[model samples]
Target: MRAIFAALLGLTTGMAMAEMKTEKVEYRDGDTVLEGYYAYDDAAYKGEKRPAILIVHDWNGLDGYEERRARELAALGYAAFAVDIYGKGVRPTNNAESGAQAGKYRADIDLFRSRLNAGLEALKARPGVDPARIGAIGYCFGGGGVLELLRSGAAVKAAVTFHGSLATPRPADAANIKAKILIQHASQDPSVPLTQLGDFIKEMGDAKVDYRMIMYNLAVHPFTVPGPQYNEVADKRSWAAMKEFFLENL
Candidate 1:
């Protein structure tokens, strides 16, 4: 009888894992084929409409890390999808290549916004998602992308950025922002220094936008990812802040 009970438990656990599902989604941005990852908890979303979040990936493009983040959002009863910034099979194996690919879009704001829109449209079309309660979150380069999404007056309810660059060529464009913005950053990050953050804050202030910036002391670039620079204290607190913000807004 004990052995039979153990078998039953194993079967139940396997079924549960299967219910928490993920799939690779093939999409497009004007002729460029994009590959993305979509994840959701089948059991939680059954017969119910839930909020959907569009996740933008780091400079490395849409990889395992982004999918894991999507799955985490799914566990919170969100239909999460990670969008591909680069074209299908265009992943960069090294920093030099990644920078070049991400730079092209960053240089041309129109192109970048369109690419993000393509993904947002795809996620919003999902049947299980509540189209009216849509939001977005980004990491690294992706974080910067979502800010641009808000600046372009996208139909997002909320937008969150994690350690993303706050710089843009046209600061006045913040006037067009429609979504509530939250920026979580590492204070000591070399790429996004205090001066840049200050200017971003001033832009939002001048535009009378609803936004907030939270900085973590002693935390540097890429603190949330699994690496030597990861700060457990900062990560835990920042993640809690994001969860709380989304719960209230989305």
Candidate 2:
């Protein structure tokens, strides 16, 4: 996914880049101002409709990591949008703060879905975007947020969760899910217990939702990021799986 894009969405008011445009955008969910980053190769898909991706950031909220992924997607010929779940200027500086802000959304599933759905709206509104061929990917806290989006039936073609929380207050809401789901888990991760994963599997089965779950050996929480347990192999394989899944479905 890391190839140079020919054109980006353009950075703030258009940079006139001949290749790859990255831009910061301001959107809203209720009165909360949300800032997001988006990237696309307008020229790559010129006059041709293409799929789009919506990203929910990790617990720390919108940051460079998510935007970097957007560029990667743009390189692969997809419009990618990194949504702000914690609102503009609300990025968490530490794990404690990250947990607190993410907890707020977790505690209120409706709010979490509302904010994430707003991000989806932003993605769908982009020029040349195919509203029917949209997908979402999230990491950590954002991982759970994407599940919330599916539970709320946001109409995405697919959803991916990387080391995301499996417990949900409304497991029965899985009945409303329409998108295919992929869950990437770390085998040795301490944060998300096997028990939660089991319940999630049962929930998805009970709802008859299309889904796939993968557990990587010797990996742990935040395995895809810069962390003690980061497994390059696992990260690459998981991303490949996601890309393939989206290709088949979207």
Candidate 3:
């Protein structure tokens, strides 16, 4: 089913663009110090506090792909922070290392949430950011992290997930969620089966959550990435959907 969905969405539009400037920013997560890349439109000058979006990376942690997404958001006139989840400049190149790092973070959900929250704080502290109007988006593992933030009752205007897992061990309080959510899923994704998808949708419905789940018939895992796994059409459409969603919600 996921494969089928990927295929269907594969025939859509092409990619879009905007130039970006990248810089490193630091923040503290309790005793641990972390760093991330801040990408914004080159057109942005000093003293311009624009709306911002936090971009979370996959299990591989901070990498060029995530940075590109941040640039894309910046091009759209939003200050985008591509956060690092695995400390400063520590990106795993292989799947094994990525899984190991992800495992350590998942083993302690509180710590994981704290790290993400710290990143959020860092973004808010930026000179041009409007602390009251922030949003988040993540890919793969980061997608799940963004959802966890929403589940934790973080005060944000919007959240978006691309090919992320939908199920969580602990259910979130419906009343606590303040952000509108948009989830893009690959219909035939083996990682998230049909049963899990149905259960997730049911839970959201029962909670009366305001959300939209877009299943791309022809896209698969890592559909939005720019590498070999990327599907140009799906990436473009999903991003368009996200841009529209954020514009309306945030």
Please identify which of the two predictions, 1 or 3, would achieve the higher TM-score against the true structure: 1
10 residues in a row with least lDDT, candidate 2: 1-10
Q: Report residue 236 deviation for candidate 2 (angstroms).
A: 0.9
TM-score each candidate.
0.92, 0.91, 0.87
RMSD of 1: 3.6
Q: For residues 160-235, what per-residue lDDT tens digits would candidate 3 score against the true structure?
A: 9999977776665555678899999987678788888887888788788899989898788888876877888888
- What is the lDDT of every predicted structure here? 0.90, 0.89, 0.84
Compare candidates 1 and 3 on lDDT and give the better one: 1
Ranking by lDDT: 1, 2, 3
Q: Model 2's lDDT to the true fold?
A: 0.89
Which stretches of model 2 miss by more than 4 angstroms?
1-18
Write the residue-wise lDDT of candidate 1 on 126-168 in tens digits: 7788988888999889999999988888899998898888999
TM-score of 1: 0.92
Model 2: per-residue Cα lDDT over 83-194, one tens digit each: 9998889988998999899889989988999999999998888888999999999999989889989999889989899998988999999999999999999998788887
